[model samples]
Target: MHGLFRWSSKWWPGLIPFAILWVLAAWVSTVPLEAELAANSGTALKSTVLDKTQISVAGRDVSFAALAFSEEGRRSAVASVEAAPGVRLVNDGTRLVAEAKPFVWVAERDNVRVTLWGTAPLPASKARIVEAARAALNGTEVVDRMGLARGAPARFDAATLLLLDQVAKLKDGKIIVQDTAISLAGMARELGGREAIAAALKNLPEGFSVAANDVKAPPYVFQANKDPVAVTLTLSGYVPDNNVHAALVATAGRKFANEKIVDNLKASIGAPSGFSAAVTSALGALSRLSTGTLIVSDREVKLSGDALYEAAAGQIRAGLAKELPTGWTTKPEVSVKPAASPVDSTVCRQLFAQNLAKGRIRFETNSASINADSAGLLDRLIEIAMRCPTTAVEIVGHTDGDGDAGFNQILSEKRAQAVQDYLVKAGLPADRFSTTGYGSSQPIAGNETDEGKLQNRRIEFLVRQ
Candidate 1:
């Protein structure tokens, strides 16, 4: 029994050391496997398609158990794990995230009809969108062609409703939604419509994003009509802002001095490139017409009027297109007025009075300088003066009772000389016009009101036999 005990004690010590070494080796091998499983699992979770994943590792072999919304996602997760160091085998245990299709929708608007198509995540969402469309486009027809899909992106209902709101603002366009991606393309009904839609997109829910936005602004329209009998010019249209509105009004006033201006301009956004330049060129052409209408729609200009002569008509028709901005079109329908019979000096005098009675020549504010607005009236006067080249006439200037009498007299005289200079430059004989000035002493109207003051300031062409 003692001998058996001694053998057992010696063997026990050796066996203990061997057992400790085996356990240490097992632990060392398991550490790598555990570390590999943790790393691969972390990589799989970061994938957009992978919703959930379970990773198991056995001696360089990896089994990837993942829940993915798509087959592509499952394959991606597996591929990622397989590329990891020390991985040998991948057992794909991936399942689809949902059994149904993804949600998609499209809303199209044309003229007076709104059409809704594609798929909705829920029946309630489909009904809600249709109802919203009907309400937004009160008199227009709303057609729904949406189907049900099980898998929808987060906040799908809110995104669709927002898109529908934008659809109502468009004159004609389409909005599309596929999962979290949204697209809009079409023409806006009013200025700033495109900007408004883009601004609204900023409020889209998390996980939603804009794919494409191709919305466009409607064309800007400008209209002007000149009446010879009434001697008035009426302007109506939309300007980009108040600055542009003021500038356009001032331009019209300067270009048509003889004609009273009735401004009906409104301020808006979305003026096309070179809108102000285009309007200015059109007004310059309109001043040459006896009666005319100018319409500027977008980059297209249409002018129709009666010109003073055939040469003038041809010049305007041929030259307007060249004067416009690039990519601009001009359509001129100018007809020359029939030539009048030659008249004797007495008849010429009467004709001058008759035409001058309709409108007056204008001057710069508080100066003898001629206003650009007076050019059209002066042109008509020149036409009459040319008809009777030999006739002697006195160009008399008068002023309102507003300034120093001496200053007014000098201003009036300088103004008469300015008129003489303009006529001579226009090919009229300088000696035929004798100049004179009568200051505020010869006021034609009371100076108590602005209208009275304007009437009092005048120029008279008197015949000298």
Candidate 2:
């Protein structure tokens, strides 16, 4: 009996190796089956709207877990797993995603950053919206504060994307979307930005409509700087349109006739009411200054400069406000220039010669009336005449040889008398001035060309020592 027991134990050890081999072979076969089932289950859920999707296979059984956007989606996801090839069973751990009522979303911008908030329908939808905002902002910081939810209306993603575009145009503002309706409130970053956003809303996807649009445009501004040293009047900033732009330039030409006009004005939308009238009146005040600057922002006009004299300064302060359009206001920073010291007749004569060399007194064509463009030069002459208070002056007039000699002589004499009348009216005594006309007989320049004719038709000042 002992010898039989020893032989049986040896045979049982050999059977242990065969049993281990059989178990190993079974595990290897089940591994491939589980993998195949998991792959097919995921493939089945590809068409479903689900978040945090997961699938696990133990042999032929699939454990499915996901948050679904709708009740139908939840049921379909589990059914799809069960129907996958080689999947024998499905353990569903799916729930419907949180539903939002009258789903609302917003994008807001401030000077520092742009923020996006509210509910998103799906994980993919949330990702796409954030990506779109980042792309639109062009490096501006974007803060996302969104939560996942269901119950988004049809084309919710499309509506949200379009609203984000409008948000980009705001300097500081917000845009909101509730279902298929949108509302916007903010200040536009540029002159026409508000209108651009309103225009863009017209092309919203079908079934979408605007609820309220309160976007406001930035200030409409125009500016001019008169530089006495540079001898230039530079115009800059916005104009309402091309017609207004041309009119403003023409007015400047008449007002600042001696200064070079540098036009930097741009045509844009959104000018204040009575913008042209306010600007025109303000420019007139600026023209009376020795050097000045004018800024017209909305309906407010600001003029700052040194006036030619104290009486002129007082007149500007009292008169500018009255000249502006209704509802327009003016702030004038006017001061009188310092008066010049009296000089001898020789020095005065040299000053007169220098002033006339720069610009001549102009008269209307075929008439004795002085042109408006000569006002600036005339003022300079008056100032120089004031410096030589005791000196007697001879005012002489000449004309081009384009007309009959007799008519030219009469016109020239009348023009010299007009100068004497102007000086007499400006508080200068009449006895200190004498008038004469040489007509075309004293021909210092030939009248053959326009340039020579311009030189020939001039007024000369002779300071008597």
RMSD (Å) per prediction: 17.4, 5.9
Q: Give candidate 1's error at residue 451 in angstroms.
A: 6.1
Give all candidates' CA lDDT scores.
0.82, 0.86
Q: After superposition, how far is residue 66 of candidate 1 from its true place, in Å?
A: 30
Off by over 4 Å in 2: 1-48, 52-66, 79-93, 338-347, 350-462
RMSD of 2: 5.9
For model 1, how does the per-residue alpha-carbon lDDT over 1-465 read when each residue is reduced to its tens digit?
999998887787788889999999888978777686668656655744454467877776777776665677667777888777667777778776544444678899998789899877655677898998888877789999876655888788888888888998899999988789898899998878989999999999889999999998887889999998987899988888888888888888777766799988888887778899888888878887888999999889999988765556776787688788998999999997665566678988997797667667789888998875666667677777877777888999999999799999998898888898888876678889999999778887899999999888988888775
Q: Pick the candidate with the highest TM-score.
A: 2
User: Residue-wise lDDT of candidate 2 within 16-85, one digit each (tens)?
Assistant: 8899998998878888888888889989999988988888888788899899988988998888888889
TM match of model 1 to true structure: 0.64
TM-score list, all predictions: 0.64, 0.74
Name the candidate that leads on lDDT. Answer: 2
Ten contiguous residues minimizing lDDT sum, candidate 1:
44-53
